[model samples]
Target: MVRLFILLAAVQLVLFVLALISCLSAARVRNAPRLVWVLVILLIPLLGPLAYFLWGRPLPAPEEGTVPRRRRAPSAPDDDPDFLRSVDTEQSRREREALAQWEKELENGEPDKPQGSA
Candidate 1:
């Protein structure tokens, strides 16, 4: 009975210290302010620190070298194969459109006079 009480008290003390350290070192606390967490840990004892451990602390950030893989954005269009292919298709389409427009203009009898000439 007394031993169990002592063990419980020691556990609570360890949890309190851990919660305080986590709150102080955290970049951002979730759900509540740091002051509130500090107050709760100091004032309410066991339950307060337990609550902080459960929900207030942020998850550990990924390490510098062990971060999850992601597809990087191409720095230039030339670096992207899809963009290179699309550029070819787009240039051809523009050329075809311009030829069709010129043919239509010829059929309509619009003289292709040089611009800026009287």
Candidate 2:
């Protein structure tokens, strides 16, 4: 019974150390919320470290080429009627062009470039 108690205490101490280390390491990374990290360390103990292992690492920033700019929200509807009308006109023109091209392709059939065609 005494041996079992000592083993349990040692295991708990190791778990606590692992959790603390993971939490502190995560805190060093920029942009991590400190308060949320502290709560994670205290509330979940063993699982907290594992959770952080899986989710705590920072996500890579969008790469240089082809990454869309992050937008907070869409621009509000334009107040000027003419400006809005111009935007709508531009969009409709593009849509009509796309439809015309698709209709032409449908009439002509697809290009015969698919692989494995004898």
Error of 1 at 94 (Å): 46
Residues 1-118 of candidate 1: C-alpha lDDT, one tens digit per residue = 9999999999998999999999999899999999999998889979999999898989777788896657897998899999999999999999999999999999999978899999
- Residue 74 CA error for candidate 1 (Å)? 33
Q: Which residues of candidate 2, in runs, are more than 4 Å off?
A: 27-32, 57-118
RMSD of 2: 14.4
Candidate 2: the clashing residue pairs are none
The residue-level lDDT of candidate 1 at 32 comes to: 90
Tens digit per residue, CA lDDT, model 2, 50-75: 56556664555677787666754445
Per-residue error at 34 for model 1, in Å? 0.7
